[model samples]
Target: MNERLNRLANLPLRENLQGLAPYGAPQIDVPIQLNVNENTHPLPAEVHRAIVEEVSAAAVGLNRYPDREFTELRERLAAYLGHGLAAENVWAANGSNEVLQQILQAFGGPGRSVMGFPPTYSMYPLLASGTDTTYIPGVRSADYGLSAHDAAEQVKAAAPNIVLLCSPNNPTGTALGLDVVEAVYEAGRASNTVVIVDEAYAEFAHTGTPSALSLLPGRERLIVSRTMSKAFALAGARIGYLAAAPEISDAIRLVRLPYHLSAVTQATGNAALKHIDTLLANVEAIKVQRDRIVSELTRLGFTPASSDSNFVFFGGVKNTKAIWEGLLEAGVIIRDVGIPGHLRVTAGTEAETTAFLVRLEELLTQGVNNSPS
Candidate 1:
């Protein structure tokens, strides 16, 4: 055998090797992109300038490693979350995905289980697998709402070590009511399991919904993870954080890589925080666009979920693949969820939304005319 092939064939690997398709966001260069749920707006000029200045200042310290503790950034994040927590209760990572993986590393392992609701963020199972933890899923109801009763039952039966809940859940864009989340938390508490509230889209929730952070003070096992990628429009900057009890945060820190966050990343996030008002102003605009998109989709005979995030999920227009292809061909990109007949579209700029709607109409009309009488 060739030397390279002989060396590669002897490498050790895990037994859990039923490979799954890799997860990826669409990279189609479309004029109207509503596929990945990214903030359509860019950082304001003032924020960009502040970030450049801050990173420039930090450049002198390049010879030194970043603050492994991330003390200042954690403090800022704690304050930004409005959770009455101090820096001791917070941790940062390259992104929310890394923060999540750290949590799994700290709390999950072989013989222990992690649980999530299906049709939610697709990354949950992968994270569980990466940590050698068993994953259990509870399916959402037809309306995309978690059945609190069913969820409680599942927790009692599965006795998972970690429970992952995503508010304003991705793809579907439906948020769990505070009451439902509280009920789930109570169940997790009784089971002595950790509950992670993934609030990546919490900023887009309706006015009345309470963030999981607000419920953290009394719940020792509850951990809330937030990302700067969504409402903050810092997807490229890669700053995400988790707020938990100090002990839990310490455990996560144990697994985090030193200098995982670059000085520029921290600087960019700090600048973004200083301009939270500007960032949220764009969120308000997206909320309005989300409402309009949902309404238009419904009027076009799609059963759209009542979305509280910057995206909308709809169904009942069969031939989802055909529609997706037609839209892509027309320079529009949207996500085709694995769930049959369902599609998720993000609320982009008003002009992009308009273009998507126009393309959607054309596809639907063509589909109708081609159908057998």
Candidate 2:
């Protein structure tokens, strides 16, 4: 083993954390990076200016702690959601991962368990483990689809205290229907399970697809988590939030640290919200590229899942590792999501997408295909 690992192994780390790898995607510098599902587009110049101006204003007040409640930020977010939701129904944190962690903190722990459908966000189980909660993973269909019957039946059987459903699931790019959401909720009613719908990729979902936020009227146990990372082109901002019952927000308050969100974060996020339209201007363009990647991959005889999100998950590789190395050699870096014979790639700029496609085609033509023995 390497010296770094050897040194770490000698430390007095907790047994549960011992030998557990940190959650991370490779961050190699490449000409075209489609590994992480980050927005390829940068913020519009106008939004950049607004953020700069707001943060500059906030800088003067750095001597004092920000409003612990983040009142104005929540108000703006509630208005943006527009489901008649007030600030009381919203909660913000470092990211949706933290938001989910706080959820597990408040509602999950020892003796209580949280569950999720697999090949979804890889973070769900990690978040549960971090909160000292037991994690139970449910199975999805061969095609990575989870129907209402499948969800309800599994939820009823497991009876976990918390259930996480990732819409437009990561590494699969398939969306969960509202029918599935309703079924899981109904099944958990007797047990009072908290159902969380992670919608980090919500904004990139295809038109006419409804958000889980629309289903939050009387479902007190339901929480819809969202992020500005994907569609708003603000991954660097590290702001994510959730909309649920006011009581749910109140519960999270018990776990969140005081002044967790800084004045600069509140100001920058508010500024971004004010220029939402401008920030979202590139979403359609990104969608067009995403669709192009899917169609082109299909035409190349690869089976790419129908993608509503800003990325594509394609399969049918006989040797994913070989293709990964080949792509890297060609300066195109994508993700190997630990799924056998499958990989995912975020939709990059038009030129970057073309580069990826061309490089992939060249590799295929050069006999990079390695069938499983």
Candidate 3:
């Protein structure tokens, strides 16, 4: 390990990336794995067949470069979103991470900056650094909530070139009200800030929760990003996209690689969009399990947050590390997101959720120890 570190240090790495660790969650091979916020439900047979058929057709054209514009995929995505968006208003990349990275490359760099509220998605700062943009860390409330007034105040004060808002925020599972998005956008108008709302977990959000996509009508600077990885059960397919003004997609074109999205990826995303209703049925099931996790966690004496996503973020653990390890020992793994008394767990299928809850309850009852053995 020391030799590997020394080798890396000797290489001419980018200054910003020198000391950084790659982003990832534990991929432990446990029977009940809920560490990452994945839609643990399997795909429906019809969707599976559609993807297979689409990929098989796309495979025949592997000899040629894919359509640089990916027009059909964009059209399908726009129709899926259904806020009167057109294909020209959409852009996509390998995944949402790449989509964000492309955004940073286009709009952020040295002398520019991006701001994001902390205890939020961990990638915003990394993306900023990778693009040589300064990252401004904004704060959240004591309970990890951000209000419209406070959010607007912070935006007005910072005036960053780019702003990232994660709705149904990661590691917290709470959605931001559109009021906050509107306020932040209004506040950033003075700075001409490009605001991005990442709705990776939007499909799992509670009923009546409005998406930031609803705010896109008159706001050319606002971008609403979504991912098929979570709701469409397509994590391995790596399709993430955004809806914004046509000019935004045009701007991203300047920074995006030629034919960045492959033929197979376009085919897969198009096929999945065809079966949107079927895939979303699974989202409803996940929501049921999510609510169950929140209810059961509260009853178990843990302070679970009001989750709008498919995961539950809870505190009130006596020994977080101990409980995490205890569950691992019991063949059920969840996320210990480095918060002192807090952890996040993905709401998986019914059996998977039950396995996690049962193991967690047993560990709490045992008063599991965190100290080194």
Best-to-worst lDDT order: 3, 2, 1
The reply for model 3, stretches above 4 Å from the true place, is: 369-373
Error of 2 at 340 (Å): 0.8
Which digits, one per residue and each the tens of the lDDT, describe model 2 over residues 1-373? 5899989999998665678777999999988889999998878999999999999999999999999999999999999889899999999999888999999999998889999989889888788778878899999888889999999999999999999999989978888899999999999998899999999998888999988998999999999999988998889999999999999998998999989999999998999999988988889998999999999998887889999899999987777888899999989999999988888999989998998999888877877765651
- Candidate 3 residues 304-360, lDDT tens each? 999999899998887887788888998888998887789899999999999998887
Per-candidate TM-score against the hidden true structure:
0.94, 0.97, 0.98
lDDT (Cα, 0-100) at 269 in candidate 3: 94
Top model by lDDT, which number?
3
Query: What is the Cα-based TM-score of model 1?
Result: 0.94
Worst 10-residue lDDT window for candidate 1 reads 13-22
Better of 2 and 3 by lDDT: 3
Please report, in order, the local distance difference test score of every candidate based on alpha carbons: 0.84, 0.91, 0.92
